[model samples]
Target: MTDKQTSPAVSVTLESGPAGTGSIDDFELFYARRALDRFRARLGRQGLLDLLAADIEEGNAFLRECARTSDGEFNAGTTVLQARGMTSAEFLAWMDAAFAGEDERPLLAAHPEHYAMGTDHIGARVVENIGPHVCSFYMGGWGTAAMAWAEDADELLPESEYPRKMSSNLFLEDGTVVGRALIQFGDTAEGFTANLTVYFPTSCPKGVLDHHLRHYAVEFRNWIVAAAEARA
Candidate 1:
């Protein structure tokens, strides 16, 4: 990825409206809400919730195996971000809220039209337009003890009594395993370090994989900043 950052272009056509009418920004806001509503409706029509419960169960098991074996059939990568003036606990508290759906604004605000539904600490269904593909996945995350993925036993931080670790697994609608993400945080004297690791099938194209890495960089950075701002 280039060091220079560029925002996505918006193509809005200005049209004259009646007196006291809303501005283009207002229309964009309305459209965004409508889009989310449509997405929610589509998921409802597909009976996704009923299937999601089962998918989460299977997906968790798949992720456990992946964590244990560190399978060669999957390609893995990590992105580390440092945040000053924030403790690891603080960052994790904000993250817990996000996962529980107490407040998703920070996550939704990270990107345009990012869709998420089903608010549970253990799982959520999300649809995101990442790179060349519009991807859908069932995401579930929890601490190492909850994960019960034995390999994590030796990975705990010595400095932390209850070290924060979020192991997230991604699965398709049909219960097909697609990817896994592990988010770990460690406290530093200055602040904390956030480590994000993603795993994808070996069959994934290099271009697609690279784009996802960049996507993680963009979204996570936005999320961390948003979290810090919220605390302020």
Candidate 2:
């Protein structure tokens, strides 16, 4: 296949949102480059989501950290940009080259992390610059570990023209729900909380969505208590 004719199997889709200014475009490029690094350095696609998500999380965490240091306000994704003081293009190119070489996989591995048990790997992430402004909320499971997890309601007549709301747990090939992430905007001037809720099917089953959601009330409370201790 020609270089331009690369197969569709290995394509990457940027999670599109409102386009930003010139510098924001560069920021997107930099994050995209980080995604490329994970695609290359990881032991094939078996760990792609975790690797990529972790990279993204770490970058957000840095932004939170910088906010604390400067007594400033910033969100997770762009915080890395504000702290590093590099133009978007420079960061993007640096990340791209930092991951050159090796036998790139023929097909990206499916079922990354062999199916992580509800954020087991991500929970262990030591986020530098993590402040009160940014907290990756943990949820999804059989007990009191869920912060929040949502799902979609099926419609009776689905011919497929409507944009089906992308709700519910993010899944891998095996159909196991990984987690859901949201950039939460609250009453604070900081805007919102960068939250990620990991899901486990056993805890969040079909039919009693309300009852299942109630199980997480304690988890949020637990996070608050833990945060208090950390502050003390």
Candidate 3:
């Protein structure tokens, strides 16, 4: 990590859209350059599957609530999984083996409350990593999920040939409009960042959006910490 006294170790900035829109435009976060490099090194050696598994396990409770509230209808949005150890092909193979089998269960099976009994399979591309320095995964269960992986700073692009941002309209089973959620990934000179922007319709409650944001942040941080620790 960099010296906090001479240079700040970390910083967070929040910017919201025009009031009354019930939307978040930007939430910029920065991590120390050295620390980020260490995390990236660890991520590659440890692999994204392990980190993702840890993340889902840690956030099982919040995830359950989201699924239950949506009556089992939800979307995973865009999640970025960073790595370094293996090439894109190896990463995809590792992913297949990790979730392979006909009788697979949700990755959060440790928490019965969040476990959905059924075949939980994810389809991934092998030719290359989703963005630049990362591999992406799409998970299907309560609703669906899309994720990207970044192994280096170059992978995080505002726009890329591969799918960098994921968008979807969530709706209640009864046809009620829930809201729209957008997820994107990028990288700074020092670290990688994920942008999860959700826009709830005026009819939607703010509490719901708040919970989702909190949950996402918690899970992201948890994974990074877990990956860092494992690398150590």
lDDT leader:
1
lDDT of 1 by residue, 1-232 (tens): 5435887696666666546678878777778867765665566524543545555455444444443454435676777787788887877787668867655556665665354444543358775543455555777635434345414533333446325666766766555557777667787789888777776766655655677777777777777787798889
Candidate 3, 158-223: lDDT as tens digits:
564233454444433223334455655544444445566554344224454554455556544544
Worst 10 residues of 1 by lDDT: 150-159
What is the total number of backbone clashes in candidate 1? 0
Q: Rank the candidates by TM-score, best first.
A: 1, 3, 2
Tens-place lDDT per residue, model 2, 1-232, is 3213444666554566758544555787677756755755653434544445665466344433433353321121101001122222332233234223232221111111111222243332211111211223322232223323322212211223222122233223222333342212122232222122222223222222232233233333333333333335
Candidate 3: lDDT of 104? 27
List the global CA lDDT of all models.
Answer: 0.63, 0.30, 0.38
Q: Comparing candidate 1 with candidate 2, which one achieves the higher lDDT?
A: 1
TM-scores for all candidates?
0.60, 0.22, 0.34
Ranking by lDDT: 1, 3, 2
CA RMSD, predictions in order:
8.3, 21.6, 16.4
Candidates 1 and 2, the one with greater TM-score: 1
RMSD of 2: 21.6
